[model samples]
Target chain A: MKRAFGVMNQHKVMNDQDVRRALARISHEILERNKGTDDLIMVGLYTRGVTIAQRLSENIQKFEGTIVPVESLDISLYRDDVQLRIAQPIKPTTLAADISGMKVVLVDDVLFTGRSIRASMDSLQDFGRAKEIQLAVLVDRGHRELPLRADYVGKNIPTSLEEQVRVRLIETDGTDDVVIVRSGDGNNSNG
Target chain B: MTLLLSGLGMVITLMVDVESNVIGSQNVNAAGTNRKHILDVDVLSEDEILNILDQTDAMSEVLRRDIKKVPALRGRVIVTLFYEASTRTRISFEEAGKILSADVINMSSSGSSVDKGESLLNTGLTLQAMGVDVIVVRHPYSGAPNLLAKHLPKVSIINAGDGLHAHPTQALLDAYTVRSKLGSLKGLKIVIVGDVLHSRVARSAIWAFTKLGAEIVLSGPNTLMPVGLNLVDGRANVLPPVSVQPDLDDAIRGADVVMALRLQNERQNGGYLPSLREYIRRWQITKDRLSSASKEVLVMHPGPMNEGIEISTEVAHGGRSLIEEQVTNGVALRMALLYQVSAGGYQIEEEHPNGQ
Candidate 1:
């Protein structure tokens, strides 16, 4: 749902330290699930998702002392809702290394509705058939319309349809935090 | 005094209402809105051109992948209706549509029902009945795509090339090639040589390059040059001023990009030139002539070149020539256009109850 701007209630759900810890925990979980980065590749959706993926890669490299390949995927072409919105300029999808026979982990900031993840998965298939495909998201605010679930989630904020979860990272937005903007009566708080 | 003041206020309010309606209609004509067709570059805003170029970059990335096919327009139908013969434009449009997974059907006037005197309107209605999403059209008459657009409100019309009027896609690819090489087109000198009288490519290039802030200079034989181009369609207000340089060498000197147009033999039955030899000697883009341009000057030609007659083989095959890259970019550029026009403006379903 499109949120109307101005005079809305903004609540910082996760601060800088909280974001860092959640990403660190998610990174450890990814490492445990994939078993030491062997034949592992990270593919991040464009914009903020790419930076979060890079941070996860750094955390993994520090823990395992091994570097994993990171790629960026732009799913604008694969979007199911191409007719719903105005067309924006497409960002380049870079997958330098071959992804065949590798465990591909798709990373993103917030996983809501799961439509973007669906589009990302569709885009990844055109590159090559992966050995396996997994998804990692920093926040999973329910309301998934697709039969999809994240393997590693940083936080679960359980948001209402009128609320929006925004992830601000240091690389893209010059900060690290997650906020929920609630529309209507500003005094109400369910947290 | 009070009565006169009230009358003035009413007039001002009415004027503001009229101005807003005009602005609203213009917004509808902008790309990605109610503008479902691309008939010419003259109607395209600067932002629309930039948006198309930026999208072409992403399409180029798709072309580099091993599996060049994307399901962007899957299950959609695109028809290429050509009233004239072409090699590259038709093939490139077909390739672009297929790359996006659109089922492309190619029809030519020679073999199709068009040969049986089927009117363009009838042909369009037939395709519409088949539920084709887009029509890439090329015709011998100018404004053919516009005519199709007027009648078929549901179908998107992309003008491949229409008479001596415009070839917007070709001009776009040309701009993409130059911009990729030269970083930016702003304040650069672009010299277009030869056959300006019957060249749709040149006409479109004049609008596109000038819109991108490149100064355009038209240089060709006197007989082939149109007099007072401003009078062509009364688009002088929108079209940037272009100078006609009769001396090809002078035009090439200090130029940033030199474009050579094919001397169209099929359209030149009126003795527009005294002889091919004389045309070659006076207007041919030889390596020596190119040497006078900027050292990093780029060369371009819209294909099926008359080689020795308009441009020398050495220059066409030279390191600076972007002829082949233009062909590659042509497919990518058309892919961007096909994707943009086909994707938007559908009656979107209401959001799922679960908010998908």
Candidate 2:
């Protein structure tokens, strides 16, 4: 209980160095599993995931000496949990790209219950199809209700279900960090 | 408005299948019956209307939450010339034109040269000379819109209900009305009752319904039915499908819809009918008539209805009536037509040879 309290506090929040180390490990794993980067395509579910996919593609290109195409998706309409809460999530507009006969790797910052990844599939159909699609996340906290498991997971942090994960990136927030807050964070709180 | 619409919408008209080689545009087949609006009963059918609706859905996305303006009809001029009077129909065109950024000139017979008996042909020619690309006309003379269209080589004529002729836009909206209510126009039995002879809405509805695969049985009094007139053919303005008995009971037997057209008692001036009582008893759309028909039948009319004369107020306001939807669709459809006709001319990256 004491160790969990230390991890949940602000002092142990992931910084830029932690994010770089995690992405470097993800880049090597993604290239290794797919055998090479030539047949791979990375598409991030917007908005933050879009930046993550681009950086992951760039990192993979640098480490493995091959290019991996990147795309971004917007999935506001295809969510099942939207009516359960009044959160009006304005999905970022997706970039135009035809994804036919290619493999797509959908990326996100955090995968908790894995529902967002399923909703992303519904949004992806408005565009064309690909041979296969895989999931890649930076943080995977396993309290999942849906049958979604990431192919490339950077960190597996098991915590109480009340804890909420917040991912902040410099491209969007002028800072890079992944922190957990309790039910009283006031932002991600149900209260 | 020079509207450069991307060819994205493709709504196929029902009976007018894609394989059918028949189309009745004014330029192509003179043997056509009503070439003015009936492009194809099947092929070049309402797929274009459906496409327009689809493109409209797409364009609405572009409009986002901002002021609804696209650089669609930027440099073009659309002239709204009406010899008669209208509030809903007239404003629909104006609003549609303004949204697409077209300069609109509203001309009425009350003030314009129409009072001096200026020919629709001469006025069309004058508008054509003024670089007007499209003409939306509502004249009291049946087929005057088409006659004006015949003279204007460069201008596309949109028939906003000609005098006792046919209202193509009204029919398009009616089709949209059915599409919205029932989700599709396939094999829907729409029995159009009242003023079949005189309602331009009826003529346009017949052509469009046949195109959309909605089987229709036009029913009304003998004096009101305008049959054997040489109207424009849709499939090359080919011959109109045949005129039969205008019996209301037989028409409504198994219909999926009953569209009641208004009775123009003012136009009749007590000459066409013996009495309003007789007209209502013979042609009025009642709940009983509807009840005897299909349970899921829809009731519709293009407004200014004769309460007990053509249809009971109960039926008009009661059930299955898409009367209000028709008016709303009129705005959307006319917006679509104006958007398609005028918005793309100035924005043309390549010259279209069809630019006569």
Q: Please name the candidate that would achieve the greatest lDDT relative to the true structure.
A: 1
Candidate 1 lDDT over residue span B28-113, tens digit each: 33343434667777667677788888889999999999888887888889999999889999999999999988999999989889
Checking candidate 1 for backbone clashes, the offending pairs are none
Q: For candidate 2, give the lDDT of residue A128.
A: 58
> What clash count does candidate 2 reach?
47
TM-score of each: 0.88, 0.56
- Candidate 2: list runs displaced more than 4 Å: A1-191, B1-46, B56-66, B231-245, B343-356
Task: Report the TM-score of candidate 2, chain A only.
Answer: 0.84
i-RMS for every candidate: 2.5, 18.3
| Predicted complex 2: CAPRI docking category | incorrect
Superposed on all Cα atoms, model 1 deviates from the true structure by an RMSD in Å of 10.3
Tens-digit lDDT track for model 2 on A147-171?
8799888777775777776777899
Question: How does residue A185 of candidate 1 score in lDDT?
Answer: 47
Residue-pair clashes per prediction, in order, are 0, 47
Second chain TM-score, each model:
0.87, 0.78
